[model samples]
Target: MSERGGPPQQPIIVRRVHRRGHGHHGGAWKVAYADFVTAMMAFFLVMWLIGVGTREQRAAISEYFRNPSLVPGNATLAPPGRMGPGGASDSAIKLGGAMDLPHGPGKDTRGAAAASVDGRTVEKEARRQEQARLQELMQQLRAAIQNSQALAPFKDQLLLDITPEGLRIQIVDKLNRPMFDLGSAQLKPYTADILRELAGFINRVPNRISISGHTDDAPYSSGNRYGNWELSADRANAARRALLDGGLQDAKIARVVGLAASVPFDKAHPGDPINRRISIIVMTRQAEAAALSQELADEDAAPPAATAGPAAASPAALPAASAAAAAAAPGVLVH
Candidate 1:
């Protein structure tokens, strides 16, 4: 029972409907997931940096991002809290890690680095202060010498220099104004006065002192039969006594050496007027004493070969005599 058109008739409808992705909601979600992953990776990198970087390095980095000009060199940068030209974020500055801060007593790396810097600064300051004090002391000594009327005559004969050993004052002898009378160990009145003034300065400083006596190469004709070595020693001892009498503490004087003609001022010209002088050396550091001691030990430990020439000759002569006896005895043995 099929009617002409009704038997096979189908309904027809026209409409448009948008369907979601079968596998995914939308590509927008994919973009969000990618952003999230990138943020997590950046966070992990920041954590790693924070863990390994020193306090100073971290602060430098933070300060660099905050104000690139503040870095050692004037490097250009983008604004703070923003990505740089290469898409590098300045988020490290905002993180405020342990190294980002200025180190206090026990804050972070900042503290430790600051402590080291401060310690170095203090040491430098101490050295500068010490140098200034030494310069001031030298100036005072110069002024004292200049002001002393007694030292006026010896001013031209005096030579002063600053060495690693300390202050060295040399008193050269003048032909007419000798520091002492001929063949006498006593200091002249004027020389004594000069020493007194020098002694005052020496007593103020906390350094060891040495007084050395030198003599001209001229042979002793004083009729006392004393040579330059004895004369030089007497003179050194006399000077040491004068210094002690003039307010220098006995303990402060480290040594008194009579160099005689051994250490001349002018080796090429032994008769040079400057060769006959006394030297007062002040020791600034203990190393100077140690060096001097080593030098003395080396001198005392001279090789035996250098000193054995006479002894060796004597033994050689004995050997020759023994050979002559042996040759003379050969004929006697036959008899």
Candidate 2:
């Protein structure tokens, strides 16, 4: 203090108080918070979609999430330049076609088209061969029925026709000569002989068979449980047994059902004896696949508790869900 002439008697100390700006809650924290909110919103949106979607739709969505890069129509993330053979960017070669670029995106359009055409052609050929084989089978069945002494008398009751489903052979009930006892599932000796004769030819073919029973629309109320449904199903099962007795393998029976007057042969007269009949359909490959898919869908829709006992032992019953999925593919019957 004495060394300086201006400040003489006392030394003055200047103290500065530096105050920090309000608690530095930086923009980074805000950014993190915003990101969290956005992620939560997306999560909620995905949950809503899953809740409303069907099984197939849900599977598709799951697949998309698993690999978003593989989704169609997604823009390819690439630099605008030629990539060297080793995958390095080569700036020297500019991207140009004949007019403006050398080539389009790296896609094999010709190969894809060729593959699609080949697939369609193969399917067409398969269908044609299947049709021819089924036609030959139909002719053989007609000849066999006409030649058989056991089935010759009952020829008027048998109806054979080729349908999109394949060869359909229906044995209609006559007013005078019913196939079964009056209102019973028991088959007459003549009906059994006819079914057995058909089975001999049916077993020779690789195609699977679908058996169904139909009934007239008469009012039936025997007790509380027994009805036309049970009767019809029993009759179909009886026919299935007869076919097995005549050499048809159990695995060859693709479907056995009871229509119970729903699909009538004589629609004009629902109560006609002709409507009360048994139908055997040799399923085409396409028809069999479609029918199996439908059955699987129905089974998946049913509850687990309904898959047991005689009430559930109908032909409409499911095998295993895994079995259904494993069998689901476009082709002839695997067995």
lDDT of 1 by residue, 16-124 (tens): 9987667565578888899999999999999998888766556656654553322122222444433332344434563322223233343334345556765766666
| Candidate 1 residue spans exceeding 4 A from truth | 1-131, 221-225, 295-335
lDDT of each: 0.65, 0.73
Per-residue accuracy of model 2 over 194-288 as CA lDDT, tens digit each: 88888888877788888978789886687756667677778999999999888888888998877676566776998999989998989888888
After superposition, candidate 2 runs with Cα above 4 Å error:
1-107, 304-335
Alpha carbon deviation, residue 34, candidate 1 (Å): 36
Where does candidate 1 clash, by residue pair? 103-110, 103-111
Tell me the lDDT of model 2 at 134: 80
Q: Worst lDDT window (10 residues) for model 1?
A: 67-76
